[model samples]
Target: MPPKKLSISRIRAESRVRSDDPDLNRSSSSNRARKRYRSVAAGSSSSNASRYAKRKRPPQPKLSARVLSILEDDMRETQVQNRFAPDLRAERQNVSYRPLTLTQKARRDGADFQVPTLASMCCSIVANCFDSLLPSRDNFDAAAAAAGGRSASSSTAKKPIKNSHTLKKTTSTRKRSKTRAFGAAPDSDGDQQDYVPSEDDTPATKASSRSTRSRRGAPGTASSISSPNQLLAGWTTSELHYLTRKTSEQLRLLSLAASFLLYKTLVEQAPQYLTNTIISTYFLPPILSSSAASSTASTAAKTHVWLPASIPLLSHDNSAAAFLVGHLTSAITAAREYRFTLSRATEEDIPLTVLPSRLSLAQPVSFALRSLQLHGLTRLQDATLARLFEAAEPGPQQQSILRLDTISLRGCIAIADRTVTAICRSTGSTLRYLNLDHTDITANSVSTIMTSSPDLQTLKLGYNEHLSD
Candidate 1:
């Protein structure tokens, strides 16, 4: 193919014509200026323009690469070790202990003593057995001996007298005449049932009657005596002591059983009874205490009681078990020094149980908690205040509230560490509502509590000058 050469004169003539047109010259100069401005702007400190010109890539950490490689090796070793490690199931089972039962308590209460069990033996157990002011077995036995030479079985002695009356009433006219001469009231039902005196006699009156009857040696006109077991039901100083001893062991067992039963019942039952405070204050304390922690299974039975951990730790059954938890909470509240004594009278006499000795403080806390439900604040002494909080059940998730609102804590009141911990852990989540106002909790304790419970709603740290967190 033939190629044609362009003349230099032709290109020069076209450049001259373009340069002569004013708009074309202006547009060429303007376009050149725009290119220059864009180049300057791209090099400037404005991040968007610079980013568009040069893309940034993150720098890889030099140490991270090596560390990850080492971690991978360690993980492989861990997996291998885990395959040969001792079974967690075995270790956990070995550590597991069964709680003590309340069977012996019911048996002891129902015992029919044949040979005299020395009052000293019974009294020794009675001394620290309970956390209440119940009476001792010695006092009961003494009262029994003083009443008559009879025992708890003595009421049955009159059964033969009743039988004789029955036989006599069924006999001929001679028997009827004999019954009339004895001034026997006509058997109203005609079944010939013997008349029995009521056993609910006042202690002093009953004692006086016994003395008078003993001196006179005259048999009572009534042929039947009510069962003596009914007479033993009331609380005397002696009976109180005995009941205190018996109830301690029994109550502990029953409480554990109730907790176990609570687990099974929670599925089918409405969550009603088990409260966060009850589990912490009543059930968990002894388990965590040095006393229970240090003791062996055998010693645990003697020293403390066992609760079946198999069931859900908390139960919401509104049954008697729930009432039991309530009683326990009340007992813990009543166990304050000031509650027991307005002035110093007794020191060693303070009863020590898993629960409190006095049940009276419950009334005040119950009233206070009710007031809190309506008024959001209830004024109470530290002891009662502590109890009201203890009685309040946890939330739906079993979370308890940390309550210190409007409480006056005197030096006489004592709260345990376990209780404080329970409050801290349970109240951590929505803690902004806390009212530690006027509580004597120190700064150090408050800080410790805050470390556990991070979300605090309202904490009165002013009076607690010692606290700082």
Candidate 2:
């Protein structure tokens, strides 16, 4: 087919029509713009490169060979051997190196011993197999003799060939004589009946007999754990126990390294609490139940211990907060229980404080904060305040409302008469000290509080100028 050609005017008309097409204009314009940009960039780069090349720095002047050699010689002479170089072993007389102390020496010695490991077990097994395969000459000879004798005796006697006709009678007579000497009856021809077993003598029974005999000769019994072969396993177990002890978490960090399996085993066995390592010169003990972290206190006393130990960590370390996530209720429960135990354990009212402030740390109860001193509690949502009340619920044995003997609502801007009513409802029966200073409460609610809190020792209704007192 001949190539079709368009006139110049026809081509101009087509170009104008295509220019009106937004798709074609957009696509072609982008490509043209890209090419123009590349060309401009190339030109600019070439010009910059030439400009920089023309302004190239001249070679720096060098000293004559004789001057250079003289200077280097002088430099070498004054070098002083670089006494304060990067080498760590370099020591100065004025600053003596730190000596290894008794503790460091003990640590070094402890680190010298290594556990029998999993990787070396394969080598031991292979070595044992190789030793078994290479038997000594005496053993080989004995085994060969036993095998040959057993095989020859196990075979059945065939009919005598024509060549052996003369000797067959002699052979049979010799076998008969041997069997008779042993006092067993001989077979009709060659005494094969003497070796044949009865129907009751099964292979299973013979195997059982052999096993029992071997067991009697075995080296170890159930109580015999003192063998050298067991030492490796026992040592490994002890080492793992030592590593998992909370003290090891601090001490072993300096020297000991652990594989994943060992690390996992240690974590699984480690206690949930801290332990004291340096007790009576021993590194760590089997357990530290008496330690601050793992106290054996009753639930209430444990809360007293746990709250004091954990609250600081929670305030300072975000990561430590996870350890106390589910224990908030338990802590409150313990506080409530503490009140009960104190009543039974002694005559005095050991004042206690349930957490009245969100940001305050837990502390030991010299006297429970029977005086609930809270700040800005009124700013908290009603639901949150109610939740706090709910959390303070006592155990089944507890009878009194949590020691709300004294409540000082100081500097609370958001409290109302209804809030005081709620507070009075919780602690109304036992309250002895009531301080409603700098609050929004009115005399109307004050009467209700006084009515509920019959045991109040002192009431400071000051700074509530709106009370019209």
Candidate 3:
């Protein structure tokens, strides 16, 4: 088969027809321009046109003037109604439009549509139930009559006699009796019931009843009628006197019990009955007392008060317990008269020794050092003595050992010059007597004591191997 060949004249006519079409000419020119631009962009270094070419976006459809104006009005109204939004009209000439959030929309529309709270709903349900369960007035009156053996009609007379003058006199007398019953004197011990006025009562009768009610419940009467327990509920003189009679061990146990009870009852009951001051003043003296009882009945077994560390009041970070210990150490030195010592064998004339082991659990040894007026401390380490005196030193928050008359550091093998210096520095002005026998203190501590303590009249320095003449 032979293939048909197109003539040069036919090809020329087709090319002329294609070139004559306006759309084809325009598309060809656009394609040529795009290709030339890309080629030129690739040759440039500074120009990023080839890497990030600008995309030609389609033109957005224009909205009508009415639709645009309506959108603007809605945005303006939302901004104006938003309470949290600042007034941009005062800050700037042009205010930007922001879409209202769901919260804003709800707030704007919630004025007339309030959703009741859970509490209100529950209260309403309870009230409805209570009202339904309550007996009617007639039933309540019948029940009261059955319980008290007195009818309502007998208390509140309903019948009126025909004699007008006699009825008036009887009514006045009845009113006086009712007033005496309902509005008895505040000091009167008899029980009183509320008086409900009936429609038959006159305006004058109602006024008189109100006056009587007011007098019965006057403020002066409230104070006079208050329970005696209310006055003696807190730390009072009676508590102080009771505590003065108790032994040191008893005081410690009382404080522990009180602290525990206070912590337990604070959530459910009032804690005003037992406060920190009460515990410290009354219960703490026995624990803080350094002197043992001089009675013949006092034995060696009753010499020490053991404090357990396992108790939550002593172990935990309780503010009340901390306050009690801190106040004993800083504010109050000795709540009562007592002497301090470490020996338990001598009980009559010698000061009593409160076991340091017991004290370490409830409070620091510093509290004893601060509280002791006549100290006979012994067998204590040098570091322990130094730390105790250091804490007792005067500072911005607390005072040093006040009115310290005497101190004995006998048999303290570890007592050094530093501890003696600290002691003298803290209580030098009040220190009248000091004993440093059988200690490690040298002539240097003696010189320090002589210079620091001006009021010192008696000084004992014996068996000190370090002391040189």
lDDT top scorer: 3
After superposition, candidate 2 runs with Cα above 4 Å error: 1-330, 333-369, 376-379, 390-398
Candidate 2, residues 177-293, lDDT tens digits: the string is 333445544545445544544434566566567676576666664323232223122233333344335433433232112222222222222212122212111211111122332
Q: What is the model-wide C-alpha lDDT for candidate 1?
A: 0.37
CA lDDT of each prediction against the hidden true structure:
0.37, 0.43, 0.45
Instruction: Write the candidate numbers in order of decreasing lDDT.
Output: 3, 2, 1
Candidate 1, residue 28: lDDT: 72
- Taking all chains together, each candidate's TM-score versus the true structure is 0.20, 0.25, 0.25
Task: Please give the clash total of every predicted structure, in order.
Answer: 16, 5, 1
lDDT minimum window of 10 residues, candidate 2: 279-288
Model 1 scores worst on lDDT over the 10 consecutive residues at: 370-379
Of candidate 3, the 10-residue stretch with the lowest lDDT total is: 296-305
TM-score winner between 1 and 2, please give it.
2
Q: In model 3, what lDDT does residue 377 have? A: 21
